[model samples]
Target: MHKNKNIKAITSFPALKGRLKQLTLCALSGALLLSVSACSEQASQTPEQAKADFEAAYNSISTERLKNDIRVLSSDEFEGRLPTTEGETKTLDFLTAGFTEAGFKPGNGDSFFQQVDLMQITADPDMTLRIGENEFVYKVNMVASSKREVPSIELSESPIVFLGYGVNAPEYDWNDYDQVDVSGKTVIVLVNDPGFAAADSGKFQGSTMTYYGRWSYKYEEASRQGADAVFIVHETAPASYGWSVVANSWSGPQYGLVSPDQGQSRVKVEGWLSRDAAIKVFADAGLDFDQEKEKALQGPYSQALDLSASVTVNNSIEKSKSYNVFASLPGSELPDEHIIYTAHWDHLGKDETKDGDQIYNGAHDNATGTAAIIEMARAFASLEVAPKRTISMLVVTAEEQGLLGSKYYAENPIIPLDKTVANINMDAMNILGPTKDVSVVGMGKSELESYLEKAATNQGRVLTQEDRPEAGYYYRSDHFSFAKLGVPALYAKGGSQPINDEIAQYRKRMNVIVTGCYHQVCDQFRETWNFEGITEDTQLLFEVGYDLANTSDWPQWNATSEFQR
Candidate 1:
């Protein structure tokens, strides 16, 4: 359904030779002197030209178009764009049509749609938990479900094991599962790390949350160890958010890629237990939760309690088809190599609770990101000179469903991973006015930082590292899907500056926006939004892509980065 004219590939010359050739050609044609004279004459008019050009392009960006897209995507009509639903069909059709109108070729050779088979699981709350004669109510304590359809295995009634942080980090010399055979037992693990609960707070990353602390890693590690069920005790401070957030998150329709071969590489059941419910389990096991917390802060500790817990989980898994929309502008030269721009088009569909509004429009969370991708595609298409390397624009699905769309693409890439230069991901963009700095979330992880620095400098803007690395934002977005495979990714945000007052005021404003409207339905397009930041950010993004597209060199991970080996 998506198609664009395939432009002829261009030959890539060495950077220095390319510049020299252009200069020589200009000089031989006597255009260099004329260009210089014209530049001198139009010196004062350059700013006007730049402003006019940018405004014209910016004006072409229809807020109405964005609203139209958001209204449909978020409306009750789309049913929240859930995968495999009518919503998904409508969403994909809209994106496919948009890409076609934007003049992009089918990214996957001849297909605009990348088929991602998925399994949709809906859990029944009536499942019972039984440990020997002791039984606990499932609804109040935990919610369990499996990705597998016919995973025939009895609930393990073996003793529960408390694996400190449940991490296997070689760098930190930490292994919670060390010397323990948790073959078929349930593992009760702490949400975050010891450093998060430490008194000094400067020990490990100190509340900054290492990868070991993430719930995803915990689940993955447990599943790898062949644990029957992994229960992560949720706490506000250590987990970085309240249990209500977790409850709401897990209650949603869960999604995962359907194995092409239908082979099983996933756990039977994985779920979370409320902190209060976990405390009751510990109490029944004659283990003190407070004591464990206090001792864990003091030093390393691991224990396998003889307390055996069992549960019978009944869930239905259905196979469904989700889509990843791909569109690209072919390179003039080195078309095999690619530079990918990604943004997720999915959000938490409709939630009836928490302020009466049912639609999670996600206008700012991702609608802005999706809109930005379209605009970028248009800009790249408008360029007179095609990029040297292929430019792939990927608007993925189900980002709100735990980065499933991006994850599938990363694992089964249409283009080989080795030829992929770098992934530039746009999540929530700044709808506020422009600032003087641009913030890189996972800064110093790759050579992409250098490229961004160059782009920022060109725009008279400064590049900054994230002020709050403790947020672990690097691991939260779709970029992490690429990063996990050693692909370099850059997740940058619009920066903040003291436009009229102290920098603290600017930061406060940013925090309010992030915490308040970030995931809420109120993230709608506003007339008061100054597109200065969007314009500057988009231009910087273009420059980054341009540098990558023009050069033949591949971007590498920084030497000190853990991903680089």
Candidate 2:
């Protein structure tokens, strides 16, 4: 129910920073000379001995252990592992114990916990939106929130402008706001980019949603554009999810890092309007929604609508602290450099309004990822010869809350980002079974794919692109946080194609749960679930990390990648 008394927390950044300096010095000093010497000896071993060492350590990733961890973490007793809740206490305790048992030293100085200050903003649902003369109810036709960290957000009769996709990508030679000034006005944008609408036209990765298509990017772009408010018209196909997801996800308590400005530079209000509601709103302004959308797909477009909108959101703000759990196996030679592995431990928590099952036990959503990271740590620790570069496991908090935890850690890193070799992120892992291939999300973004290909080959498998690249899986996970800062990140997992016909049938049944149980109460752990796929995937992660850890390679982003440093 509570953290072990042995566990300690690092309360100040100055102290944490000093500890980081101390750790770096320790890595380079005489203290680790013996460790480095041992690694040098291990590195010079015969090929057969090295292979045996790898095999023995790789086999330590257990499917049974993964399953057990998932069951325990996803149980009702954990209360969905929400940050700043009782669940967080239990989750942190579990992670600290797991890392200690696995022989990792505290990654942050003398403590395993790096405190992340967070602000939780729960928007009052009893809100209304008036676009022109048309009124829309909250969560019925629209869902809204503010990042401004204020008591209330209000837009009074703000002029509306259609700013197609709300993208400002100069590299794409596109900027919707280039011709229009949306400062102090409400901007309405379509979900996703023109790529989704015309995939074959070779416009921005063709249906594979670029960062420009992401709602978060849109909001950020709008804030930079000085827009008072921004609303994205939600179409299920383009958004990669239905309106229900938007409503449910946006309606809940949102967590953000405690900022100095309290999000003063952000747009006053950010929201989603149902497609039907958007259509009606456009029609009310005497604009044909389809025709306008078509114009948007062709090129940069914007139009001042003959209407204005009004809305007020009263926020119930609560400032609290969360954490990013860190466990490190200091490398033999390059302990100062890090191969960071990340997974979010926080979920949707519970919804008391639900009749029967109130707890949203996010078993598949993240419990699997959390378990995999712990196992990966265990495997690395079991190795007779530690890696040349430190392998650090960061079980971040509040991922479901807009990747706040990872974002915080990335911006304020314990191990310097420049010194961080590469990031390997695991979120909802495969539950169906082993596959002949692993699906690499945003496959072409990094050189890490080469390492992954080699690792997968060892398993007699191949690496392939994810099935739904249009979903923008790359930008949706914790890896994106590191990637945003130019760190090459790999987010790949088991493909949909099962290894055998028997597992293929099992895949069909598992697909229902995987697809439907996202962020729902039905996302609880089931004994019938298969762990072979995730286990193999975990081992593959180990292989790649092991290789990176043993070598002096610093993985780089592809030259064409937006994140290239």
TM-scores for every predicted model? 0.80, 0.89
Q: Write model 1 residue lDDT over 1-565, tens digit each, in one string.
A: 0001111122321221222111110133444333221011223335466445444543455545554554455566664555555556666766766766666777876667686666656666666666435565554666666666553434766668877677766655567777888887888888877767772765556656656677888888888887777878888877777766766566534666676544245555677777777777777778888787676555556776778876665555666566788888777667788999998877656554557766656667676777778777766665444566888899887677678889999999988899999999998776665677898986778999889998888767788877766556788888888988888998986886634454446557655755666556666555445545665677678778868976898889876454665
Model 2 poorest 10 in a row by lDDT:
1-10
Each model's C-alpha lDDT? 0.68, 0.85
Model 1 TM: 0.80
**Candidate 2 lDDT, 268-362, residue by residue in tens:** 99999999998998899889999999999999999889899999999987777778998888887787899999999988778777799999898
Which residue window of length 10 is worst by lDDT in model 1? 1-10
lDDT score, residue 508, model 2? 88
Residue 444 displacement in candidate 1 (angstroms): 3.6
Q: Which candidate is the best by lDDT?
A: 2
Which residue pairs clash in candidate 1? 9-332, 10-332, 10-333
